[model samples]
Target: MTTETSPDEHQQQEIRLALSEIPSRLEALHFVTADARTPATVPNHQGRDEPTSIFNSYSPHLDNITNIALFHNEDQTPMPSPDEIIISQRGRRRFNNGSSPDSGSTPLRMPFQRTPTKVPLSTSMILRSSPRKRLTMGSTPPEPEPTVMPSPTKPRQRLWRQGLPPAKKLRMIEEGGKPIAQLNEETPLSLLLQGMSQQQLIRLIVGDLVAGDAETELRLRTRLPMPDINPMEEELLHAKRQIFRSLPTSRLCKKTDSSAYSRAALHLNEFKRLLTAHTKQLYDSANWDALLDYVTMAWPILRATPHWDSATHNVTRRQCFKLLACHCLAAVKNGGPLLGMVRLQATDKNLRDWARDFDDIQSCQSALSKAISKGRATL
Candidate 1:
C-alpha cells in the first residue's frame, strides 16, 4: 500500500488527520476566545482544579448540558458537568455531594448556610409564632404595659386673643355693661362714644358716612347746609370727565365692560351723592325757591348721565324725583300763592314725564292740581 500511494492520496490523508485533532484543540480555541477576565480555575465535584469551558462562561442554560469537554489534554481531569454547579438565588456557588461517585468520601464544608434577610414582622405574626409561657400560681400575669399612643397634635391658632391689638383687647374684655379693664363687650355704645374725644367721635362718624351707611348718611345730610354751587359744578364736571375717560379702549360684545362699568358706577354714585346732599340741604334750610330751581337744573344732568340698570341710574332717578315731590308739597303749603304758581309750572314742564314711573312724583302731580283748583275756587 505504501508503494502504490500517490502524492494526492497522501495529502488527502493528512487533511483527515488534521480534522480529527480539532476536538482536542478546543480548549486552546476557548482560551483564545476568552478575555483576560476569565477566572483561572474552579473546584470540581472531586475536589480537584479544572479549567472552565467557553460554554460555562457565556451560556445561561448551563444546567441542561450533560457532557462538555473543558480539558486542554486527555490526561487532565474533566470539569464538573452543569448539574454539579448549583447556583442559588443569591448567586452563591453550592456544591452537591451526590455529584461524586464515591459515596463513602467525606464532603467538603461548602459554607452553604445562607444568612437570612431581616424583615419587619407584624405584631400578630410574632404573637402566633411565639411559645406560650405558663403563669405561676403565686404571680398574676404581668399586664401588658399600656400602649401609650401619642395624642394628635393640635393645629396652631393663627389669630389668638393675645395677638389682638391693645385697644381691641381692652374692648373685648368687658363684663355686665360695665368697664372692666378699661372696656367690656357688654358696655353700651353711647358710653364708649362718650369716652372718645369730640374729634375722635367726629372721625368715627365721618368714616361711617364715607363707608356708605345709608341711614346715618340720610340723617347727616338732612342737617347739612348747602355749600356754594360753584364747587359742586366743578366736581360734577370732573366726575363726568372721569366717567368718559374710564370707558374701555377696546370694543366689547356686551352692553358694558366690567372694569369700565365699575369705574363709571363709582363716578355716578359720587354724582348722585353730591346732588342728594345739596337737595337735602335746600329742603332742610327751608329754601323752597332755591330747591325748586336746583331740582330743575340737577334733573337734566342726572338724566343725561350714562348708566345701565346695573349701575346707579334708576336709584338716583327715583331718589331725585321723590325729593322734588316733597319740595313741591312744602311749597304748596308754605310758599303761598305766588310760589304755588311757580311749583305748578315746574311740575307741568320738568316733572310730568317722570311722574309716570315714580309713584311719589305722580302723587305730587295730583296734589299740585288739587291745590291749583282749590286756589281758583277760593278766589
Candidate 2:
C-alpha cells in the first residue's frame, strides 16, 4: 500500500478489472433479454451503476433481436453442437447422392470422351463403294414398246335428239304454223309471237278466243280507254318508277362503293319527300287505304337504304308520326283499337316515342287504356 505503482502497471491493472466486469455485463444482458421486465444493474452513460427495470436499464439491440428470432427453433430447443451439425451435413450429402438426377439434388457429372472404333474394310464393301457403271456406245439398248392410244370416245347423244325437232325447224313451225314440226327446248316466246298479228296478240293477252277470224275477234273484244294523267302526275309517276328501279340496283352496288350508297340515300330522301307530299293529299282526301299502301311500299325502301343524313332521319320520323296518326284516326273511326293498329305498324320503342311525341305520357297512357278497354268491350 505504501509503494507507488508504475504507469504501465496501473494501466494493465485497469484493463484486467474491465475484463473482469465483462462476465457480469453479459450475465445481466442475458437475463434482460430472457425477460424484459427483469431487474438488472447496468452502467449508464455517466459511468454510474443504476438498478432499474431490465427494459428501462438496457434497451435490446436490433441485431441481437434479429439473431435470436432467426436462430431460435419452434420449440425453443438449443442449437445443435458443431460436431452434430457437421455429421448432419455429411448425411444430407449422402442422401442427395441417392436421389434422382432430375430431382436437382446432385450436381451434374462431366461426360466421358468416347473413342470411335475403326471397322475393317472387306471385298464386298470395297465393291459397293466403287462407282456404278453405265451403258456405253457399244451396248445395244432395247427399243420401247409402242403405246396403244385409247379409241376416240363416242360422241354423246343429245337429250333432245330422240323425239324433239331441231331449233331451226321449231322456229320455222312457230313462224309459219307448220303442223308437222313440234317445239324443241330452244324455241323462244319471241319466235312464237313472230307469227301472230297485233290483234291476235291482244286477244291472247286478254285471254279471249283467238280461234275466230282475227279482225272479228279483235272487234268483239271490249277495250277500256286509258285515263288521262296531268303533266305533274305523269312526271311524278315517272320519277317514282325510276326510283323504284334504281333502289334495287343501288342496294346491290352499295356494298362495293360508298358513293353509290350515299346516292341511294339521297334518292331515298327525294322519294320520301314525294311520298310525304302525296300522302298528305291522300290523307286530306280521307284515302286511308291508299296512304297505308304508300307507307307499306316506302317502308321497304327506307329499311333497304340504311345510311340517312340528319335531315332524312328527321323527315322519316315525321313521316312515321303522320302515318301512325292517320292509322290511329282510321282505326278509331272503324271502331278498332289504336293500340292494335300501332302494334301492327311499328315496334314497341317506336310506339313509346310516337306516343310521347304526339301527346304527353299521361294522355298517351290514358288513350292506350281506353283503346284496350274498348277492344275488350267490343269482344
Candidate 3:
C-alpha cells in the first residue's frame, strides 16, 4: 500500500508483513520450554510433576531450534518441507511447458459422442451446431407392411452457453421463449422504493431492512407459539444487512423515471422466495426444530402485510410485512390466515371478532382506491 511500491510490489509487501510474524512465533515457542519451572512449575528429574499427564512437548532445544530454523527460513518465509517444496514446484501443479517432444497444446475445443451415459458434459457437446437434424430410432412392434418409424433425432437438448458468452450467440436472433435479460438491466433495489425521494427511500429501506425479522419475530412470538429471545440477534443482523429498503439513498430512486417502489417490492418478494427455499431445505434435512424457528420468525412477516385491515390499507409497512408472511407460509404448504380469511364467516368461532378484524381489509381497500384516484400511490 505504500506509495513507493507498484501493485505487485505492494502485494509482495503485504505477504512480507505476514511472513515477518513467523520469527516471532518461533521465538515465542522457544521460550515455552526455557521458561518452564521445576517441582510445581518446572518438571522434576524424571518429569514426575507431569508424569501422570502428557501435556509436555519435551523435545530438546537443539532439535526444536533446527525445526524452527528449517521452517522459518532466513527469508522469514516459512520454508516448506522438501517433499512439499517439490510438490509445489514440480508435481501436480506443474503446467505443460508447450515444448515437450511430440506434444502440442490441447485443442481449444474437443468433440465427444454419447453412449447412453449421463456423464456431465459441456452444453456445446450436447447441442452442437449441426445442419443435420438429430433423430433417434423409436422401438415399436413391426407393422404388417414395411414402414419407417419416425426417427426425428431426439430433439437435441437445448444448450445454454456457460462462462463468457460468445459474440456470435448474442448476435443471433431471438426466438419465442422467456425474454433474456440485458446485461445492464436495473436490479430490483434500483427500481422499487428507489422510486421515492432519497430520504423516503432510505426510510423505506430501513423498514424493509427491519421488516423481515421484525415481522417474523412478531409473528413467531405470538401467543399461539413458543417464544425466545435467542433468535432476535439473527433477525437484527438480517434486517441490518438485507432487509433495508430497495433504495436507501440516491436521486435514482425518487426520480419519476425510476422504478423505486416496484424495485423494493420485487426484492421483498424474492426474499420471500428465499425463505420458501430455506424452509424446504430445512424440511428436507429434517431440521424440524430449526424449521419451527424459521416459521416463528416468518409468520409475523405475513400477518404484518395482510390486507385484512384498513390500518394497513394504505401502502402500509404493516401490509408489506403481511404480504411477506403470507408468501412464506403459503410456500411451505402451511396455509395460514392469508389464504383462509375470505372464507371465514358468521358461522366461524368468534365470528364477530373476525368480522371486526376483516373490516381493516375493507378500510385498507377504500384507502387504496382513494390513493389510486388521487395518484398518490401506484397500485
TM-score to native of every candidate shown: 0.37, 0.24, 0.20
Winner by TM-score between candidate 3 and candidate 2: 2
Q: What overall lDDT goes with each candidate model?
A: 0.56, 0.48, 0.42
* Clash number for candidate 2: 0
Error of 3 at 197 (Å): 45
Residues 1-379 of candidate 2 have per-residue lDDT tens digits of 5999999997777566655665655554543443333335566432345223333433565346434644442544555876675455444244345455565843322122122123342423321211212122122346589999988999897967677777663353455564531445477778867888867777776565646567765676545332222443544555545544654464355432445444455555575566557656656655444444443444333333343344544455456445545554453344335335454333323446545454432233444455556766665
**Per-candidate count of clashing residue pairs (backbone under 3 Å):** 2, 0, 47
Candidate 3, lDDT over the whole model? 0.42
Ranking by TM-score: 1, 2, 3
| Candidate 2 weakest ten by summed lDDT | 126-135
Write model 1 residue lDDT over 1-379, tens digit each, in one string: 3578888997777566555543644444444322323333332322235333344455443322212333333444645644444432236545656866874464333343332233343433322121222122122446788898887998687665775754443455346565452457687877767678857766777885546778878888788663356666666677667767766665643325455566567776677677777767767767766666666665556555655545443565566557656765675555444455656566566567765545676556665677667656666
Best by lDDT: 1
Q: After superposition, how far is residue 172 of candidate 2 from its true place, in Å?
A: 53
Model 2 deviation from native, Cα RMSD in Å: 30.8
Worst 10 residues of 1 by lDDT: 128-137
Ranking of candidates on lDDT, top first: 1, 2, 3
- Model 1, position 105: C-alpha lDDT score: 65
- Which residue runs of candidate 1 sit more than 4 Å off their true CA positions? 1-234, 249-259, 309-340, 356-359, 374-379
